[model samples]
Target chain A: MKILIIGAGGMVGRKLTVKLQGAGALNGQPITALTLADIFAPEVPQGGIKTTSVAADLSRDGAAEELLAERPDVIFHLAAIVSGEAEANFEKGYRINLDGTRLLFEAIRQAGQVEHYYPKLVFTSSIAVFGEPLPAVIPDTQVLTPLTSYGTQKAIGELLLADYSRRGVFDGIGIRLPTIAVRPGAPNKAASGFFSGIIREPLAGLEAILPVAETVRHWFASPRAAVGFLIHAAELNTATLGQRRSLSMPGLSATVGEQIEALERAAGLDAVALIRREPDAKIIEMVAGWPKDFDSQRATDLGFVGDSDIDEIIRIHIADELKGKIGRGAA
Target chain B: MKILIIGAGGMVGRKLTVKLQGAGALNGQPITALTLADIFAPEVPQGGIKTTSVAADLSRDGAAEELLAERPDVIFHLAAIVSGEAEANFEKGYRINLDGTRLLFEAIRQAGQVEHYYPKLVFTSSIAVFGEPLPAVIPDTQVLTPLTSYGTQKAIGELLLADYSRRGVFDGIGIRLPTIAVRPGAPNKAASGFFSGIIREPLAGLEAILPVAETVRHWFASPRAAVGFLIHAAELNTATLGQRRSLSMPGLSATVGEQIEALERAAGLDAVALIRREPDAKIIEMVAGWPKDFDSQRATDLGFVGDSDIDEIIRIHIADELKGKIGRGAA
Candidate 1:
């Protein structure tokens, strides 16, 4: 089986690639080759598999069609400008995220005209799609009222995927991913990074600033869980999902306070003590408008599972990342 | 007052232009000039003090900037392909409605850089934004889950308009127009036209097919009511609306059975007897997924009103259209 992963350079993309490479198979089918592409050249994986890394800007004309010409069995579309970058640079965001996605879908359709070369397209959406008046526990079926430009683009992409899938152009699944906590990287421009950074750094004994109020609750999933969702969605029978192809994937729900509590339990009180609570009003306002929880019954019914509590989430993070780095950078 | 009407070549567009010209004013403000634009050349209104008709495909680059150069006081953006057309021709629909709206808003923002030419942008959103599992009376805060590409485009437009308005780019109001009953002229490609055609034709003594069951219910507003909502939304105070700009407009709620009864009342049993029972499975399926009612409390508070019942809607049709052309084609 052949697989293509767009945005193979990003954190999730990197982790997902590693997981796919390690697993060596998807849905019991052996992976023969992997085509990894990004705006920048991805760091070539060290594995002994026939992995091809291509530096390609997928937004440009015919680029996606050129990539899809290889006829990969699965395509994981993870390429996107993060929220802060997308918000700050308006035109670039739309050009990359919205227009780029459209071009790719159209290219896939065009490519399919000659022969039957439809691949399972797994797209990563976000919680940014939900704006204010978000229920305490957001139902999977809640209307997408995206406040941010990135959110709007993602929501629009989701709609396009559904409509395209409905038309039988391709088999598609859009997963509205939660805030991936304990993200294993230096922070980029994504607005939700602060959520992960605080927990991640404190446990690593680095002093991390808490930009928002501690009471602010958010749905979360470890990097591992997100990869699991991508793999699951890629192989799952789309016939069950029908035209409403996108789903809010189930995730662990925890407030900042709970996150801190988990940090204390996993690492130590000393690690938690390294956390500084200097609330920035701007970040606070942005965070306040976000949803607290999600009733992702659809994803759950489809057999997607998440952490039961924040402690388990913390445990997973320590095990997967941090090299079991606990207790003020000492695991 | 200067007013710019986008999508002025459409059904409601023609009616609105004539009405606005006749009124010679909007919100007690005297009309100085009216700019009507669409992809097609709209019929220029005869009565406005100064009228400019521009034929421009708005989806293209720089088109909005050109339109905004005139700097009108208010704008009525009514341009959109109907649901059926959008669903069928997906790319064209998104290109015109979704991308076009964004470009327009961006143009307004760029123009505002010079002298703040932020017109009161009154967008004609639709009830198609709401799909199944809806309450009998959809509230102001109901989630938008459009089944068609057209509805998705409208919902996304509403979001962009609201977000832009909140950012102080322009004062925007999105009126979720119910199915406009009694559409004038020859039958067009609108799928929902049967709602109006069934009763109108039967009352005119022409045999009309009932594609759906008699129990089919949908929210409705006459073209007059639709115009009223547009005018009211344009004139209403922004202070009352605050940051949340889009709203569900008030309209009559009735089933097909009630529509027939109203036809019977207005045109008598003889005229109503022209109705024929013929079911089109495609149309019935389409109608089945439509919203039944709308809880338009916000629109009511904002001073937008609708006709009392289906009889009133039928009566308006008789007065505005038929013009005692009733029984001209009666069976």
Candidate 2:
């Protein structure tokens, strides 16, 4: 199987590359080659499979066509500007997120006219697609009323994926991933960054700030689970998806208090005590409009698995990022 | 008020032009100029209002920019390839429907950067945005699961409109029009043509074919009501809309049986007898998947109005089209 990963420079993309290299195969198909592309050239992973990394902008005129010159059997579309960046830079967001995705789809469609080719396209959507006035448990069939430009772009991508799949141009599946908990990176300035910082900083024997209330709830999954969703989505029979090609992946719903409790269980009371209460009204208001939980029965029935609880998510992070070593003392 | 109608040659566009010319103003602002554009130059309506007609394809490079050079105070974007045509010609559909709309928005945005300019962008959407497995009465928040490519394009347009409006690029109001009943002119080969044909052809002393069962239900609004929706959308204070700028207009939801009954009451049973039942499996299956009714309380509360019942709808069409004249018998 030949695979192409767009946006292979980002965190999830890098993890996905390593996972594919380790497995050496996908969906029981022997991997033959891999092509990775990003705005900056992605690193070619060391593997027996033939690997090629290219610096490409999919949004540019005729760029998608050039990238599709060596058509791959499976394509993972994960490239996007983060929510905060996209919100700040409106023109750049639409240029890359919206126009770029459309250009790729159009390129694939045009390629088929010259030679018939239909690849399994796996797209990463986000929970941001759903906004305020939401039900207690947002159903899989809930409408997309995104209040942000980033969410609007993702929602539009999902719509395009479904339409392109329905038209027999390509087999596409979109998975709306939950926020990655215990994110293995330094804390950023994003409003939701605190969700991960509160866990990661404490685990690394450092102090972390809690911007929102302890009762504030949100959905989560491990970075490992996120990669799992990509693999499963690629392997699944899209015929089951019918016209609605996008699925909300199952995730663990937990409050900030629950997350800290899990962090203490994973490390110790010393780690939990490192968390500092520094409330920010801006972050709280932004987080309040977000969906806290979802009835992702459709995704669960379709065989996409997630972590059992917040505790499980933290343990996976520790094992994967910390080499199973737990620091006991606070900084 | 200076006005620009992007699809002035279309049936609704032509009607809108005449209506605006007759009023000589919009929102109590006297019309200074009018610009009409389409693939072919629109007919210049006779009025004291200064008018310019241009042949323009909005999807082409620089076409939208050219249209916006004048910077009309209000833009009525009604251009689109009809559903059947769009379904048959996929590329053309996205080119004109999707790319065309985006270019227009982008042009407006760029124009603003040069000098401050924000027009009231009233976009015409359709009921096709909602599709199968629908509720008994689709609520305001029902998901957009479009069954057709045309519907998908319209849904995407709605998203763009909301985003652009939210960003303060333009003051956009999207009105999802119901199927226009008593569509003026020759019998076209569209599947939904029968809905208007059964009434239009029969009233004009000709036999009209009904390809679906009379029990089939769908939404409706007269051309006059459609124009009213546009004018109201233009005049209303958009601040109340918040982030959700697109609205499902209040429309009459009635079954074919109800429509026929209303026709019989208006022009006697002879007019109803002219209706020929020659069921086409293709059309029946297509019509079956459509939305039956909607709880459009949102639109109603917003002060947009439509015909109260099927009977009233037919009367409006007769009064508007036939000058209150009804043929006594069939040809």
Candidate 3:
């Protein structure tokens, strides 16, 4: 089937595109024609099939319609400014996150009415959709009460997806992802960056700063598991999703100290020692507001899985990010 | 303090406006001015309280901002096309219900930033936010998975209220009202009109048609209770609401059989027999989709009240609607 991957230059989008472009990609149904879109043109993948790279601001009135002229069978929407950036810039966030999404859906809905062109849309949401005063372990059924602009925007998107999907305008599924642990590449402004940075930097012999107390816990999933989630989401029959179209996904809940110990066990004590402890009030406030654990029974039953422990998570990161070349403080 | 009541010509809006005019209608402090707006201007209430009526489409740009220019201290937003109308005209539903609500919030948020003009907003939501396959009785904590366009609009409004409230941009509270029974009016297009029409028309010596099975149950409140819920929402402090700002109000659940019995016991056999049975498949399908019961623990704990029974509800209608002289079927 023809497919479009919006925001193909971002972290999740890049991985998902790579996974889809690999030889024998998408085990069952192969993607026939591929279009990769982002604010900036995406790096063209060379898997030998048809591909197009279109760079344009998605919030523009007819950008989505222009893309839909290709009539992709599947669209993976993995765009949006990150949580910190969105919270800080109100207009930009709402423009890109909320209006941009609506434009795409409206384009799809209108196109489908004219040309019978409904496509399976997989939107990547986040646990940020839940806010503070949460149950120690948030249940799959807790009402979405987002605290930040980013969270609120995501929650709004989820509502729109369910409504649009229900109206037969299109088929859509929103998977609320957990924090991707040991995220490779350089750290940015994300408050949750330390969650991955502490492990990633130390593994590469660079000392990493810990922003919050080691005892503070959070939910985590490997980037590999995230890719798996996208594939499963694309393949799952949405008829079983019923009315609750947005679902909490499964992941491991571990504290920073536990993550450190797992890193030490995997990469040895020298690598663990490269972790430095520091606290910023701003990051601490942001981390304190995030959900630490969830009772994600729905996704588990729906056949999504995550790393059993932090060790597996670290191993996956090393295998993916380190490229099998052992770092300075390796085991 | 200036207050605006949209949908003032509608049942709930009229009742709320009348009560506020009768009382001083202090929202946390004092009321200095009031504005009631709708598609048609509502009849002016007695008692000398400064009031203005505006008839303008909120779906248009700058309308909400223009309305907020007066800088009302509290805005009672009781506007919308109801269930049947919303479903009948899909475009109108999205345009008025979804886009109109968003534009109103944007106007409120913008006004709030100008010299700190945040106003207390009371939004009327509905139990239609819940669909079928309910768990015996739905709890206040149940996730919203609406099945219709009307439900989707209300759910989206609730989310926006929460998000806007969280920003400290405005103090907003959404009350999810049950179907108002003994609704004092001529039956329009609402399928659930039978709930009130069965008693309302029959008592007025006109034949009332029953469209669904006696076994089909639904939750309801009297028009008096609806006005009370709105007033209570305006009076209550939302600091206690935390992130879950929208609440499922307490209500009484009754089956059609129970309703007929209550009418018989209250208004005699003549009134009961004025009801004609004509099972409608369309209505049966529609009513079948509604929720029968709600846990309502939060609303109860928050001190909101509903009709004690169908007897008191009917008595309220007789005293309030017929001025206590039940001409023909006085039991």
TM-score of each: 0.95, 0.96, 0.96
Model 2 C-alpha lDDT versus the unseen true structure = 0.90
Q: What is the DockQ of candidate 3?
A: 0.75
The residue pairs in collision within model 3 are: none
| Candidates sorted by TM-score, best first | 2, 3, 1
lDDT of 3 by residue, B1-331 (tens): 6788878888888888888888865655566788988877788888678888888678989888878888888888888978888887877988888888889999987776767878899998999888875776888777787888899889889988987887787899999999998898778778888999998887777789999988889998999999999989988888888778899888889999999999998879998988999999988987887999989988988889888999988889888998786645432
- Lowest summed lDDT over 10 consecutive residues: which window, candidate 3 chain B? B322-331
Docking class of 1: medium
Pairwise TM-score winner, candidates 1 and 2: 2
Compare the candidates by lDDT and give the number of the best one. Answer: 2
**How good is model 2 by TM-score?**
0.96
Model 3, A1-331: lDDT tens digits are: 8889998998878888888888444537767888899999999877876889989788999999998998988899998988989888877898999999999999998898887877899998999998887888988777787888899889889988998998888889999999999788888778888999988888888888998999999999999898889889988889989877888889899999899899888878888788888888988887888899999888989998878899999889888888765576542
Off by over 4 Å in 2: A328-331, B328-331
Model 3 regions more than 4 Å off: A23-27, A329-331, B27-30, B327-331
TM-score, cand. 1: 0.95
lDDT of 2 by residue, A42-118 (tens): 99878888889989898899988888888889999999988999999998898899989999999999998889899
Computed on C-alpha atoms, the DockQ of candidate 1 is: 0.50
Q: Can you write out model 1's per-residue Cα lDDT over A268-323, one digit (the tens) per residue? A: 88888888888788888888898888999889999887777888777777888766
